[model samples]
Target: MFHLLEKRIAETFASCIGSLYGLTVEVQTEQPKHSSFGEVAVPAAFQLARQLKKAPKAIAAELLSAVGPIEGVAAAEVAGNGYLNLRLDRGYYGAGLLAGESAESRMSAEKIIVEHTNINPNKAAHIGHLRNAILGDTFVRMMRAAGGTVEVQNYIDNTGVQVADVVVAFRHLEKRTPAEVCALVAGPARFDYVCWDLYTKISSYYEEHPDATAWRQETLHAIEAGEGVEAELAHLISDAIVVAHLNTMWRLNIVYDVLPRESEILHLKFWAAAFELLKERNAIYLETEGKNKGCWVMPGSAFRESSGDDESKVIVRSNGTVTYVGKDIAYQLWKFGLLGKDFYYRKWHTYPNGHEVWASTGQPRNSSPSFGHGSRVYNVIDSRQSYLQDVVVAGLRALGYEEQAANSIHFNYEMVALSPGTCVELGLELSEEDKSRPYVEVSGRKGLGVKADDLIDKLIEKALEEVTSRHPEEPEDARRRVATQIAVGALRYFMLKYTRNSVIAFDFAEALSFEGETGPYVQYAAVRARNILRKLEERGERLPDFRAELAREAMARQLAEEDCWQLLLAASKAGSAVERAVRSGEPSHVARYAFQLAQSFSNFYHEYPVLSEANREKKTFLLWMTDYFRAQLEHTLAVLGIEVPEYM
Candidate 1:
């Protein structure tokens, strides 16, 4: 409701300014620092001050006079130097809320592809991987909430060096054959966990015996050859690990629409098609000198300004193997339907909710839902890959897909680190130097990070203890379910609260806390609202039909109370919050809004006596407010991929 009103007001101001000054400009609205000033403030007059050669105050007065009345707006006035302040019609807004009016914007016609959680199918997912998935998943939810057609994709690097190293571990170090490895994968052992340890062991082995590094290259070649025991072992490890990854993500309610694997990019000759484009367009040239000699390279000038050094990126090595970025460019082209080549997809997994996830294959399968060919793409990778992402975009531009290149978004985020306190909580021995530091970075090579499943299990165990203490009479199974919900809420919220660029230091206590901006705190606020309604039901009273009981006049009288008005206004802005967050490309904005909304409801709950109010009209208004708050809270939590438990 707020978003619609804000949009209308901005358009009205733009139109008014065009009429008054004969000049066109984009108009933007912001919330005033204090509610007493107004609900929305415009600084268009200041923007026009120099162009008009007049005092901003006079311009503001002129625009205010020229502007006609806006719907849902009570009054507009010029304030300070050049600001236009709008006060909304409280009763009108409140009545609309009572009617269950939707604030959703018009649906976007473009299909948006969000590629995220591209964890290499080598080992167990860690906390850093969790941050990527949660950020990407929440952004997808935000876009969908704003009426965007979004497709969630998880890219699998099944044929990468990470996978090669794991294959080397199984064949060379562990001395296991293809049949033995297959049996191990099919057995009851946690395959990803097993590969995690093997990956670490292989890394140490490489350090001890430098000659063993050749084992990796040999394994890579064999895997690329697409035949032999080595290739079979690679497929077995990656395929099973991918399943483990999906299961881990599903535990947090993160499901994907498709899984695009690197193997398909190779087996289907995607790079071959891309290589021809680069040659035909002169996007890449073979280097003849310097360190990049005998390799196909994209000059630095294509992606970045020259710095007087040979900074060209190698697209293909002298060995005729395409680089990661080379494959990425082809994948990006495929996403925008510019590659001309397409992948054969097969059903891979069906989530419990019946959402199907398809995987790219080398051979044709039965008819399946169309994948890729997106108008826009968002690759949710870490900030470390920004340079590679730039090169990929430059590749598209060089190939004359400038519009597609512009639409290629790199949703980069900082890595997650473990806080010192959390390290101790997890029984990780910290060095004296590390103990003093604020956070300790996790290294997959060193096997020095918390696995996603381990962290989740730990959170649930801790939450279950708290749940049992609070509601000891509840059934053990019920308590466990609620505990799981709280655990997920805590983890997802912890991952989301930080801005994308901000590195999170994961701490269990702070995240799982029942107070102070935590997920459980928000969940408790929603639970409090539900309890109010449940208690009323227990008293043998039915909820009043708010639409019938709360007329415009009654709404105005009830909303006249400053506290009531503020609470209702806050609750009604969830759509506005999501829209703003989507525009800014920051999920933290929505997270911040959720915290503020929860705080507002918490204050309202303490001050208002909804069940015991003597005035019937005011009581109905407060009840409506409670129900509305609960709905908004749950909706926001769902976007964040967090769940509210049946009980606090």
Candidate 2:
């Protein structure tokens, strides 16, 4: 609609007063901040004040008089401040909108891989982990809205220090062997939760009792060597923790097409292949002097530096263990098809959507599709790792693989923290600085964060209370099911609402709210639209064929009459929102858009009677308009990993 309005305004300016400056047309269409401002505001006089050699206000006055009549425009008037205010011909615009029903064909798609939720396979997922998964999944949905090829990948840090810490907890503290651990997993307590408590115990113990660090070192070596009771338990305990993480993310609708393990890449010698390329291309030099003696490093900040100058990241420790950064660079090389290497894959699990999930291993895979040959890769990690990620891109550029480097992106976001009240609820102590800040830090090793399952259960219970109050006669099972949908929506949307850079002081009560600026608010709006459509079907007059942007005057008139142009106008920007999300690797924008769309439609529904309007044509027009908003809102929310319940 703005596109149509822009053309009409531009033609009016260009054909009428625009001839003086010989200007063709380039009228901008931006929504005004307040209803009193205008439907769409443009300031051509400001642009030509110097070129036309006149004051902006005088120029605007001339342009207003010269502004020709457009069919769907009620009037084009110059503001007192030299701004051009264009009010649509409400009746004509509404009627025209209803007449044309075809939507613009969605954008042509592009292939994109979203790598996120690379949580350590060491403990149960906490609120911090939830933030990453929710945002990452929403980003994928936003991309797909514009017909993007999105493949979700969950990176598993099976060989990192965090995993080593958990292994230390099991062996040194729990006194459990691999065979005995299998029995323990069959016990009542969830293994992940058990590990969560044990992990924090180990962390606190090691800080106070220095000898505990030695045990961690031993476990690390045992893990790398893949020998002893430590090796056996490492695989079992690691598998259990990873499963818990997967289950937690699944609650938020975060699914993965691949589970890339850091350990598998090491076992398959993919890093070795990457090393060979580094030596072959002479990109990484073998340092024999000064601080980096015996280490391989690519010299040059040709891009950005992770640390100060003269500092080098050690690929191989003095003891021969590979650093995490080194492993990541190798994995990145394989992703771009640059190392000329491949990892063996076996179908570890099948997704709910029926897609097979393949994991990397050294052994041959009997049933695995081709993976890791993507044209582009997006790594969704937090901003603290910005320096390291920058080096990754630099490493590729040094190897003469600039195109691959260009395609690799670091989709970094801020960490999640707990609100003060939540910290007290979870029974965590905080320091002066922590108290000074707005929220409490969620430390996994300290066991100080909301458990994903417990949060979900609480949300469901709360939602059920509200649902029962609204529809007391509904069956208990049905109510529970609907509550689950709303619960997930509320949780997922809250997680996604904040910008990637903004830190949320996640208040459980604040997040659980169903009214005003919330996920359920959006869900409620969508439900109302759906209900309106359902009621319309019950009536004798069938809805006329309509496009999202209809040219007929009647369609435009109908839209304006509903006083809900706010939703129609905002919904039209979904494409632009999706494009920005993909380009910037942020989905919080989409979440905000979804909320705004739903709120606008909801307010309109509350104020306007769709079925009971005095004018039958007015009622039909409003109902048709509601249907489009409903479809777009539902689709966008789903992309944000939110589910609109049948009732809420």
Candidate 3:
């Protein structure tokens, strides 16, 4: 109701003022801090006073008289100096909310592409990667709720140095043949966990014996050339790890539409096409007289602050090998349909929700769906890659694809660390100094970070302990189901409660709590509302028929009371909160809104006794409000990717 009335009031005033004053104005709104003031406050007269060269007080009086009656507004009055304070008609607003009707659309129908969870296939995903996947999936939910056509892509870096390092480890350190490695991958063994240990071992060897680093370059060349046993070993490692990643993400309800592998980008000659375009447009030139001599470099003047001595970014090395930035530029161009190239596709995996996930292949299948060519692309990566992201956008602009460059976005975020208590809970050894610090940084190279699966298992175990203690009579399988839901909700909400720029120190105790601003707390409020309806049925009384029982005149009479009106008004802002969060590109706003809505419901639940009320009309109104709260809370939780369990 709040989102509906705000748009209706803005449009109505815009139309009214344009006719009377011959001035076009942008409508702005603010919430009144006190209940004595009107619900929606607009300061339009202050904006128009500047153009008319008059005091704002005089302008407010004139516009209020001429604006006429807005559709759902009961009265319009000028507050203090020039603020346009408006009161909503209680019957019309409450009836519309109960009916689940919304105003017209506020967004365009353009298709958007969101790329996230780009975990390297060489190792297991850690706590940091969970943050990226949760943030991306939640944003996708918000965009779809706002009427957007969205396609989710998870880019796999299979041909990078990370994959090559594992291949080198197997061949040199472990002395394994291609057929033997393939057997290990196909056998009943956890291949990804094996690679995770080998990756760290290889990192330590590179520091002590510097000559061993050449093996990385050699393995990379073989992988890029797509020849020899080393290349086959690389493919085996990456494919197994990719499957492991998909399974881990599935536990948290994260699914992708397509997987665009970097190997296909190399095998299909995407970089060659991009290299030709760069040279043709003078986007990159060969460096001659510097430390970066014999390398194709993009001029730093294109992206950096223009100084005569700016450093150039190398795209291709003197050895005729393309750098990671070069491949990234090509991938960005393909997203906008500027490159005259496409990837061959094959179905890879099918999710439990009946959605098929496709993958890019070097060899063509019988038929394929066209991927890429998105109007806008959002790449979810860490903030540490801001420089590379800028270079990719600059490469697009350099090739005269200005619009595509402008549409590309880097949805960057900081890293996740572990709280000191969590580190101790994991049985990790910490020094005295480390224990005193607020958070300990996670290092995948040193095997110091918490694995994603390990954390999820711990949460489930902890939740089950609490669930069984509360409901001992529940069946074991039913208890397990509720525990899984609570664990997922706790993890997702903990990741999203922080802003994008804020670093999170994840703690299990803070996330699983059901008393404060947590997912379980909000979920319990929803369950409480549901139990009210359930208990009424158990007592041989029918639930309120909102359509037939909740008449406009009855609602207006009950809503005239102070507490009833406040709770209804607060519940109506759920949709508006989602719209604000979508526009701001912040999921924390939605998390905060859910917490506030839960808080309001808790207050109303304690104050208003619906079942024992003697008056039928008043009881029906309270029951309807309880149902309204449940619906709004469920909708908001869905947007956050948090599911409410039936029992908890």
Candidate 4:
């Protein structure tokens, strides 16, 4: 509601200024430094002073006279060197809050495809992978709350070097046949965990004997050719690992609409189609000399200015195998429905929510939902791949899809590391130098990072201890369920509380803390609100039908009070916060808003004791305010993918 009022005020000023001075400019709104000044302040007159060749105060006086009254605005006054200070209609604003209107109302028919959690299907998901998946999933939730038709895609790099390395480990290190590997995948053993260990062993083997790296090349060829035991075993291992990755994500309520596999890109000749387009458009050229001889390279200018061919990116090698960026180019084109080819889709998995996850296949199913062809695409990747992401977008521009290239967003974030304290908690041996540093980086190749499941299990165990202590006589099953919810909430919120570009050295002590700026803190606020109503019911007092009992006049009368007004205003801004977070492409904004709202509620909870109120009318009003806080808190938590436990 605050967001809408701000926009309406801005637009009104823009119209008034344009009509009065015959000038047009973008109007920006901001809050008053002190709440007593007004609700929103605009500085349009300052910008007009330059063009009008008049003092800002003179221009502001004239604009105020020319601008008419705005709906839901009590008064627009000139203040502080031509700034427009606008006060809201308190009665109307309070009434609107009770009506529960959406603060943001952007309706779009175009589809938005968000591709995230593109972990290599070779080993277990690590802490770094958790950061990516959590950020992506939370963004998806935000988009949905903002009323977007979104498709979540999880790109699988089955034919990439990571999957090939695992295959090499199976063939050379473990010396396992295709049948034996299939049995391992089908057995009760954790296949991804096995590959996690084998991957590290293969890394060490390569370091000891560099010549043994040729197996990677051989395995790559077999996988690309889609023939013989190598390809068969590659599919089995990658498919099984993909399921394992999905299960790991599912524990945190992360689900996907499709899994676009690299093998399908090769098998369905997506790269060949993209290659011809690139060649025809001269986006790539065959080099006949220099270090890049016999390679297809895109000019360096597409990504950055260069002095010569050395800066150009290689799309295909001398052996005619396509590079990773080349494959990415094909995938990008398909995302925009420009590849002229589509992946064959089949049912991969159905989540508990009844959402069907589809995967790319060599053969099409009889009935498959249309995938891809999004107006916008957000590829959630870490900051390390910024240069590569640039190259991929450059390929799109070179192919003449300038709009699609521009719409292709790289929602990049920094990597996640473990704090030194967290490393100690994980039982990792730290050197004195490492202990001195703030964080310790984990390497998947060295099998040093904590697995996602292992970390989740630890959080649950810790949460369970807290839960058990809080409710000693509670049923065992209920305690475990509540613990799991709190654990998931803590993990997701910790991953989301940081800005995208900020590196996080995750610490369990900070995340699991229930007191300050944590998920559990915000969640406990909601539970407390609920507990208030529950206590009222237990005391044999029927819950008030707020809609019938609390009239708009009654709400306005109470909201006129300063303390009550502030808390109600804070609780009503959740929708506005969500809109801001979605528009800025930052989930941290939502987290910050949740924390602020929780703090406001905490203050309100202390200041106004609803159950112990002396007056009947005031008590009913306080109860209604508590109800509003609970509803809004849950709505905001849902956007963060955090669930409120029944007995947290």
Candidate 5:
């Protein structure tokens, strides 16, 4: 149990060393490092030793002796490195796990908002955008598993320079008006793919002439004011391209609760109100002197490594227009409920997951769906923007809303780049500058990247080949359905496997692998477990249900015996893994848990006789264990945006 382990450790530490500063042992969960080690481990002794001025060995010895007597611990031993390692009572753990009471009972629900996948509406999505959506969506699922209320937001840059650039391309380059483009969009050629090409051409042309930047500025104003022809064209472009983004994300099983547009942020005067508040409090001041004359500034950003936190940054420029930093500060404050402002929201569409993708509008409605005022806001962005995001939080503190600032998070992730071979596969001829670099950059400005949908198609096609090879007799529709799930698992897990800070050098061949340490591997494990249950059902031995069977087996005196320890031990640690996975914001725990669950099931499968066993009671118990893992693993995989194929 999550609480059981923590409680047992707390009792042991408190009872043995009550004299040692009364430091409570709130948790006994392992800080998972290498897999060769057991499922759970603790280094509490090291900390206790440092605090108590005792040798770590002696403290571990004391703690192990003190903790071992507590229930559910199969063994508690001090490791050679002064780490206190604890193993669970397996049969006890596994039996309790099957009952599902442990995790259900140990949860405190809190609301969390995860905003991600704010892909610019100007072009087709790429693998870079995939990383953001995959991670954000997975985190939302994980929070719910931990008994938290999660609100998923997908930010849309509908009025940004990127979208404006696309508008410029259609009007300036091709001379097509809004109505002409709308009529053509009703016909064949993919609207987003067309926009992608047009947007890229405009980007390249922008490099040739500096004066072209004026069109972008004018479009931004027109977008704000809701002006004529070009704005209508922009609206048509944004609407059609968003459909493209949705289709691509649907392939990966990612969905959003809301889609907030940047235009609404401006039109609603969100930044304007936030600016007034900052100016009133002197959190930001009007700089009438120096090169920043007539501009407003927020004195310091938190990420200025060696600089004092009290330093300031500019909020408004000399032209009286809000800078990017100012807009972000306003957004962050609104997210945390510090800004006395709100949006007029309209339901855009219902996403696949049964949640509404509500869009914000400038004018207030008589009644609208609630938005903003989150207790926590996690902005899933790339590491490059960490500097600016920190300033958002800093601005809050500067205005005396320390709690709001504390709740603002920069959930930074590294950029995705293409591997050399995969780069060439995209039909780009390599030059010295390209081949010599370790990885290829995905430049959105130049449109040099693999489209997200294209990658999903490739992954699905490859999976289809493998699935058909093994199940050639299956119906075409059945195979199609299974292929989609496998492709999703492959892509989602591939996106999550690396730590957020590590660069993902995207490789098609590597990501498509169905073998070890992949999403397909996790799916394969669950599929095998499903097969066992199906086979058992065919044999007329119905799979022992979750609790009824486990309750019956709990009476068996063999559970008190030493040999039953391993199964219980494996079962008991699920809660700990659940807690750690969320606490650390890492999916590897879920990955490792899925692998270990499968591994344990396999070992039990090999060791225990089910249909062949003479001991009907023990066979029933074994089935209970198998069913327990099957349920758990399926749930865990679901959390990672993975599906367990029935036949695969």
Candidate 6:
């Protein structure tokens, strides 16, 4: 409702300026620095002062008289050199909110593809992978709330060096045959966890004996050739690990529409189709000299400005193997439907909610739902891979898809690190040198990072202790359910609270705290709102019909109080907060808004006693305010991917 008023005011002012000055200008609106001034401030007169050759205050005075009455605005005044301050009609605004007017504008109908959680199918997902998935999933929710169409994609690198290394370990180091490996995957132990330790052992062996790297190269060839025992081993390990990853993500309520694998890209000749286009356009040339001799390389000037010392990026090595970026370029083209190729799709898994996830296959299968051909694409990756993402976009531009190149967004975020205190809590022995640093970076190659399942289990265990202490008479099953909700809320909120570029130092105690700027703090406010409504029912009294009992005159009378007016205003901006967060490409803004809204409700809850008021009309108004706050709190928390527990 607030966003709607702002738009109406901007349009009215833009028309007034055009009629009076015969010149068009875009009008921008902002909130006043102090509430005493007004709700909105406009500086359009300042923007046109030079063109009109007049003082800003005089111009502001003229526009103030020329502009007609706005729907929800009560008065328009000229203040401070040229500013236009507009105060809203509180009675009119509150009435419209009660009538359920929408604040979101309809977005474009074009489909947007968001690809994230591209963890390699080699080891268990760590804390770093959680950040990527949570950020991506929350962004998806925000877009959908604004009425935009979106398709989620999770890319799988099943035939990469990471998977090859694991295959080499099983074949050479562990001496496990195909039959034995299948039994291990079917055993009681977690397959991803078993492979996680094996990956570390193989990495250590490579350091001790340099000659062992040849095993990786040999395994890579067999996997790419799509034949032999090593190829079968790669499939067994990667397929099982992929299932494990999907299960882990499902626990957080994250699901995808498709899984595009590198193995399908290889067998389907996606690179071959892209290679012809690159060669015809001369995007890449064979390097006959220098260190990259006999390799097809893209010149560095295409992606970045040349500094004379810049080196060209190799697209295909001398051994005729396409580099990761080269294959990624093909994948990017397919995303926009520019490449003249398509993948055979098969139903991979059916989630409990009846959502089906499709996977790419080399062989043709039953007809499936349309997968690719997105109007825009966003690749959610880490900040360290920005260079590779740039090269992929450059490939699109060099091949004449200028519009697609512009729309390819690299949604990059910083890595997640662990605080020294967290490392100690996890039972990791820190050296004196490591203890001096503020945070320790996790290394997957060394198996030195916290696993996602382990972290979740620990959080639930702690939350259960709290739940058991507070609700002793409740059933054990009920307490366990609430504990899971609290644990998920803590984990998801901790990953999303920071801005995309800021590094997050994961601390267990800081995240699980029920006080001060934490997920549980925001969640407790929601639970409190629910309790107020529940208490009313428990007292043998039904809720009053707000629309019938509290008319515009009654709302105006009660909202005259400064405190009541402010709380209602804050509760009405949930839609506006989500729209702003989407435009700025930041999910942290929404998280911050949720925290602020929760704080406002807390203040209102302490000051006003809704159930014990003496005046009948005033009691009904306060009850209505409580219900409105409860609705807004739940809506905002849903966008942040956090759930309020039954009790907190």
In candidate 6, stretches whose alpha carbon ends up further than 4 angstroms from where it belongs are 429-436
Q: Score candidate 1 by TM-score against the native.
A: 0.96
Model 1 scores worst on lDDT over the 10 consecutive residues at 506-515
Report, for all candidates in order, the number of backbone clashes.
Answer: 0, 28, 0, 0, 16, 0
Candidate 1 at residue 293, lDDT?
88
Model 5, CA-based lDDT: 0.76
State the lDDT of candidate 6 residue by residue for 327-388, as single tens digits: 99999999999998999899999999899999999989778788889999999999999999
**Cα distance off (Å), candidate 3, residue 398:** 0.5
Q: Which sections of candidate 5 miss by over 4 Å?
A: 19-45, 50-68, 74-91, 103-109, 287-294, 300-314, 545-568, 602-609
lDDT for model 4: 0.90
lDDT of 4 by residue, 1-648 (tens): 888888888999899888887778888998888777778898888888888899998888998889999988888889998888888887788777777765556848689999999999999999899999999999999989989889999999999898999999999889999999999998998999999999999999999999999999999999999887788888899999999999999999899999999999998999999999999999999999999999999989888866465899999999999999999999999999999999889999999999999999989678899999999999999999999999999999998899999999999999988899888888888889999998888888888788999889988999999999999999999999999989898888889999999999888778666668788889999999999999999999987777776777787788778888878878988888898899999999999999999999999999999999998878998998899999999999999999999987
After TM-score superposition, what is the CA distance of residue 430 in candidate 3 from its true location, in Å? Answer: 6.4
- Which has the higher lDDT value, candidate number 3 or candidate number 6? 6
Candidate achieving higher lDDT, 2 or 4: 4
Best by TM-score: 6
What TM-score would each prediction reach against the true structure?
0.96, 0.88, 0.95, 0.96, 0.90, 0.97
Q: CA lDDT of 15 in candidate 6? A: 93
Model 2, residue 41: C-alpha shift (Å): 3.4
Which residue pairs come into collision in candidate 3?
A: none
lDDT string for model 5 (262-381, tens) is 777787888888888888887877776766667777665343656753355777877677777788788878777667878788777776667667777777788777867788888999
lDDT of 3 by residue, 202-285 (tens): 988888899998999999999999999888998889998999999999999899999999999998999999999999999999
Ordered from best to worst TM-score, the candidate numbers read: 6, 1, 4, 3, 5, 2
**What's the CA error at residue 39 for candidate 2, in Å?**
3.7
Q: In model 3, which regions exceed 4 Å deviation?
A: 186-189, 307-310, 420-440
C-alpha positional error of residue 487 in candidate 1 after TM-score superposition, expressed in Å: 0.7
